[model samples]
Target chain A: MNTTQTEWNLARRQIVGNAASIGFAVAMYGVSFGALGTTAGLSIPQTMALSLLMFTGASQFTLVSTLASGGTALTAVIASWLMGTRNAAYSMRMTPILKTSGPGRLVAVQLTIDESTAMGLAQDEEAFEGRASRLAFWATGLSVYLLWNLATFIGAVSVSAIGDPKSFGLDAAIAAGLFALVWPQIKSRTDLSVAFGGALIALALTPVVPPGVPVLAAAIVAIIVGWVTGRKLS
Target chain B: MMWFAVLAGAAGCYALKYVGSIIPAHILEQPIVKRIVLLLPISLLSALVAVQTFATSQSLTLDARVPALAAATVALRFKTPFILVVLIAAVTAAALRYFGLAA
Candidate 1:
């Protein structure tokens, strides 16, 4: 039952399709981030390079904003690193679902991120094919990576001819797109509680902490609370 | 100069991704660590939304942008398609901005 052939094929197809969907959505948000990077004094090449290389949207945004606000390069790097540390956790949690053999294992790790990891894990509980999980992660990550870099390049090069990208509502569009991705997943009391805890913590600490650090702090608090809740329930 | 940072950052990011799988399964399966790891996405994503929605240039706004939050709430409640909810939020925000009511 756990490793049936037909089920594996179906899961593979579903994962691929969802990966494409997630990839396309994530790519759309790259336009906004690219514009933002340029406006923050990043050259087109730098912005595109960031998109191509860094590939984590939140961390990229955090680094640029921190730098723009007079943060040292080291500080910006640290902040971004802290923000993106979730990928490490994602990789740890994903081991059971994506236990690939041979060379493809490397690809699985590279592709693991918030969306792919989350989607893959969600499917795994339903016993999705291990291959499907890997495919989804790669398809989504590669698609987003390519689209993001390309979009950033285009935005950076066109900035002089274009007016404020914010005025074009790019920020809102991206925010909306992200919300689109996130809103569907807020199920159960546990999920809601963590969200509430995180939001409250961030709001409370925003004035005291640096921009991105607050998010990291809130995340820590949320995880603690969630762990405590799970223990209580058990 | 920035490219150096970018390249270094990217390399670091990719290298870190593979670190978990390379470690012994026992390391990843530690009960406490496993619990925390499993909760990472929920916590991180929640924090991201809180920062984006509430903090605006170091201040919190309860204006038209508020509708984006509200729309998200309603969409989640009704189980509407995520894309539709986002579109609604954007439209609501644009209307608020149009009326000179939002920051």
Candidate 2:
């Protein structure tokens, strides 16, 4: 095949591959979030609005969990923002792929999220910094968004009558997706150490702090570990 | 209204993203920013792990039933399938509750 044709074909496969490998868990986790939000006392519209508007599953879940526990709107908003700070990093990583333009800029921002960010980076070495990767990245984001919101609505509607989420294995959905996301990134002993340290810090902080904050604290610990060890490696 | 908060929150989020995208390519391409951004996923994932593993229904617990530490260890050693590891750990917890190991 010609060079341009080859690039197009490869991009096509990457987009499809990302969807197959990562899409299901990303979408299903929305169901878990929806159910949990409803059980936490958010109404159907409230839950749907969170999924449709906020759309970051982690942030949405954190917001509702905090609200359920009596956290104010301001508190919930800050927590969600903190939870989503990683998207900025993802955006940075994708900057090269989706070249800065008026329309491209808006689309890129709309598509920024955990799965697309990771999937965009997962493209082959050369593709990582090219337009093809951006195409794949946007595809992943749009597909996940559509699928997630739809599944979330289904989950919210069903949660009221479903009784216990634990009974249906719905609670495991988020854990499963997180595991998938984290697994591919563990490339070295240092990464493993940082992971362990963060997980430990999170465990230790859980009792003293709220649910979402522990994760934030763990992230800080990992960043410190990265900064400290990063110099030696460089 | 709550809907307004949701819209504002959504708008704020997209605005932050647009701000990130608007930085000139040359500026964002700087070596320092690139290096730091590379570690962003680790930061986000760290937050996620801490919350899920440590925080329980209302309180944090180091109890055996949660066993996230152990499962993560298994995930490391076997390079086990992520979904499989999550299933094993989650099943352990639900089974514990089912069998009266913990509440």
Candidate 3:
């Protein structure tokens, strides 16, 4: 085949691979989130709205969990925003790569989350690099967005029929889903150490701090470790 | 109150993303920023897992989530399919609860 045709095929394969890797997992997790949101006292529409608009798993979960526990609106918003800051960082990393414009730019911003960014960056550096990366981004972003929303609707509607969400162990599913997403990223001893340190920080602070403070504190620990270790290595 | 929080959260999140998108690439590509971004997800996600697993209504406790997390970790280490990892974790927790071992 000609170079262009071969490149197109490679890009297509990469997009499909990336989408398939995380799409179902994300959709399933969306169901869990939807049920949790409803159980947390959010109306079905409100739960759906969070997924449609906020569109970040950890942030949405933080918002609902905080609210469910009687946290003030300000606290919930701050917690969710803090959790979402990573998406901003993801956007910065992806902006030059996406180079999108107009309406597409708006949509791209909406879809810029951990899964899409990771999928895009996972593209092979050696083959049809740019095109494949963009394809992976769009493919994973679009598929996850569509499937997640649909699953949210289903979960919200079926929540009553499913009865108590906790009895089904849905409460633990969030951590499991997050764990799955984070697992592939920890590639080395340093990464593992950082992860353990962060977890320890969060755990140690959980009892003494406000609902959301532990997470922010853990982020600080990670940042300090990153800065210190990075300086040392450099 | 709920509506206000949702709208504000959405707007804030969108702003965060837009600000990142508009920043000049050269600025974001700095070595320190790059390292921060690389390390951020690991720490953030680990924090998330710990909070979600251990905290219940601003309080910490030992519960089924601990063992479920352990199971999920093992499943992940084995490169189990994502769905299976979730299922294993959920089932582990549910069984523990059913057996009166956890709340």
Candidate 4:
């Protein structure tokens, strides 16, 4: 191991706080998702179903927001499925590292989310040896999974008493939640271009297109941005 | 309708992950394919935010969501953290509506 005694201590500290911290943060996100689900007119069971099955924060948010705006179920599903495509990208890096297979592959796939992937990859970058990376992945993933679901249940039931979700400003809160999710990802000018370009397209098309179709149509912005700006990364 | 979206959407997303697991890495790692996959969510999520904040039905309207998002931007600019940004936006919108200023 290339790690020093001090480095081991530091890594130990990180291991202690890292997954728990990430899990707490994601629990907050899950609470918002739960509230958003209910405010968007989903029943409690439906809300829980999305949390348990859909699992991905961005995809779940897309479905709730699309439906809230009167998009058909098909559009809602497509938009969420589109959002979840990023998970596929992450899984590209994750597949070989995790080396999961058979029935265990199913379990691994559930944890193949943004936080777990990021944590796992960070450890892999730190130590080329796979042990630390795998540990980080499971610890972070399981903590996030347990806390996120529990918080969602709490948020859903708590908000059930509110009258007129708009009066509570949940609509704006939902948008803000989406914004927060993307803000951290916008670490570069090109990333900003893609995000802003996509927002412009969606806003422009919102009036002309059907409620959900604009979201789907906005997919072209990323395609064009990647072609012009990001194509060199073979 | 509810179960259809929940179950089918989950299935679709899970399928994407499962596909990546089984697919040849060389194919999935193709530059253009990789680039687009990385960029796709950024665009779609930003687009969704726009639609949620501005659009109501077939028309774009100015409302509390606008100011609320603006509040969130300020909070983000200050590094106020994610939960606070969300809370700020909600509270801003709620305050405005409570005062009968914006719906």
Candidate 5:
């Protein structure tokens, strides 16, 4: 019993440490979102609603950026939806591991995001009975949700004091945050090639296409690269 | 119209999550689907970075974001903390703009 208690304590500490770091990092980016969202003409309440309901960073940013560029509502929604689709893939990957049901399943789905999924899957291999993984998921999800919303409120309220957010380069912070998120994922030659190719396509199309269209068009590059590479491997 | 878009977006996002929950594990685990899933974020995020950094009001223009993003790339290469990466990028761009070096 004593050893079991010790193990539980160790697992709790480990999970909390990981969750805290990721949650804080994510919350900082939420500030950038809040400032930019309001500058993009979203009311403070609207910005908060996006953070609360959509609760996905990249999708929320895509929605606001689309709107900022005078894209039609339909176009903004479509762009946001495309980005949100990734959460579906995340949910598919997580549901089996979580094995939730009924109301629990619904709640779990709401908390599903890239950070939580990554934290859950990153548990120490030697931890027993899945305790660490479960704790990591719940802790990271809850903390990030709480901190991100709080940061958003703070940022929105303080936007006036900060003057033009762009003057402070807060607008560029979004891309920087995104770049940091994607940095650790590019581990292979294929990943590097695909990323560069997609970025180039988007850049080339930006001047010619509508605001949100280039992003959608770049997905074609990803599909072709994945298909061609997969065929070659087979 | 904005409210309508937000509500529709919320509903669509919810549907995506719910649909993922209902799909069979074997189907989602297929090799082709898995490969696409893995590659999707890399491509999509890179595209997003490009659009957000370089595009403005339906047009592409060079600006302080270029140098700021370059600084961010260096910070990321050194494995700086994520928050620091953003701060470095922001400060770099802000300084450039303040000095009349970039719009």
Candidate 6:
């Protein structure tokens, strides 16, 4: 849904409503991520950097848990990178809508995560009335980014005062949140198969391989599935 | 090591995003590449679920998190919000742990 400049004049308030809701939801997770990061032994600044740079919740959590579980730096990076790959996929879709370069492109690409993309594309109605989607994108992205970072900082600081996070079962909270994040993406039969296969592969390999390797190794399932799908389409 | 991990992971993840941003849409739209891209996050996230719930480094454990995950699954089926799903799972595990049921 490419948004034209002439179509962007409205800068509708409806976009803000959607962005705020998404922002609030993410604000909750930002707190969780912040708390989880500290419990994973990340300093506030380290955790902040993750929220700031990586910006995506799944990738940040992946990095924390991987490193905490004694995965090597290489594996940690790769595993988190794998988790972050969806943004790349999101980026591919966002490129046309964003249609910017230089400094603007840098900022837009950074904001190109699930929330913004979802909001942006939601306006791609049956007609070519993709007018408000770009506003949705920018508003949702900026708001989520700001709220998430602030909440993350708050969570990081306050969690330490809460004593051992396990008592609060924050670990389970993190996993559940992550599963929720991915669940929306599981919309098709192929997606289901890949998820089941990936989890199976990871579980089987967990006891055998290093901490983060199984996560990476699960890519085999996706590759095979993709290959089969591609062959069918061709 | 952690500092390196954090910084490097951020760099690499952003680089991936940059690649997607810069790549020609036609190139990304290649059937195989598109399929693979779509599936990567699905597989990786499920792999993460298995890892998060069951495994700890080179070991495996059966803990309160097991039932907690089941509860989370139910919450998902009911279409609970993301944070609520997480809260339900957390409370499930916490209560189990409190009662000395699971470890």
Best by DockQ: 4
* Model 2 steric clash pairs: A215-B47
TM-score of chain B of each: 0.79, 0.63, 0.82, 0.96, 0.88, 0.92
- Root-mean-square deviation per candidate: 5.3, 4.8, 3.2, 2.5, 2.4, 3.4
Better of 1 and 6 by DockQ: 6
Best by TM-score: 4
Candidate 5's clash total is 0
Task: Give the fraction of reference interface contacts each candidate recovers.
Answer: 0.34, 0.27, 0.66, 0.80, 0.63, 0.77
Q: Write the per-residue lDDT of candidate 3 for residues A1-234, one digit (tens) a residue.
A: 898897688769767976976777788878877876887778899999999999988778778766764566777787677667778788988887888999999999999998999988887644564877788888999889988888888877777567777777877876787788678889898889888888899888877777666766777766787788777666
For model 3, report DockQ. 0.59
Q: Which stretches of candidate 5 lie over 4 Å from their true place?
A: A124-128, A232-234
Give the best candidate by lDDT. Answer: 4
Off by over 4 Å in 1: A1-22, A32-41, A57-79, A89-108, A114-161, A169-178, A226-234, B1-9, B72-91
Which rank order by DockQ, best down to worst? 4, 6, 5, 3, 1, 2
Query: Residue by residue across B1-103, what tens digits does model 3's lDDT show?
Result: 9988888988898888888998887765666666776777688778778877888867887899889989998888898976788789889999999999988
Least well predicted 10-residue stretch by lDDT in candidate 1 chain A: A165-174
In CAPRI terms, model 6 is classed as: medium
> How would you encode candidate 4's per-residue C-alpha lDDT over B6-99 as one tens digit per residue?
8888899888877777777887667777677778889988998999899998799999999999999999999987789999999999999999
Task: Report the first chain's TM-score for all candidates.
Answer: 0.67, 0.71, 0.79, 0.90, 0.87, 0.87
Candidate 2 Cα misplacement greater than 4 A, ranges: A1-22, A61-76, A93-96, A117-131, A164-183, A203-212, A230-234, B1-12, B25-90
Show pairs that collide, candidate 3.
none
lDDT of 4 by residue, A84-172 (tens): 98788777788788878888889888878999989988884446356568777878888888888898998899889788888888999
Give the candidates in order of TM-score, highest first. 4, 6, 5, 3, 2, 1
Task: Please provide, for model 6 over A44-84, each residue's C-alpha lDDT reduced to its tens digit, 9 standing for 90 to 100.
Answer: 89999999998988888888877766678898888888777
Candidate 6, which segments miss by more than 4 Å at Cα?
A1-11, A124-131
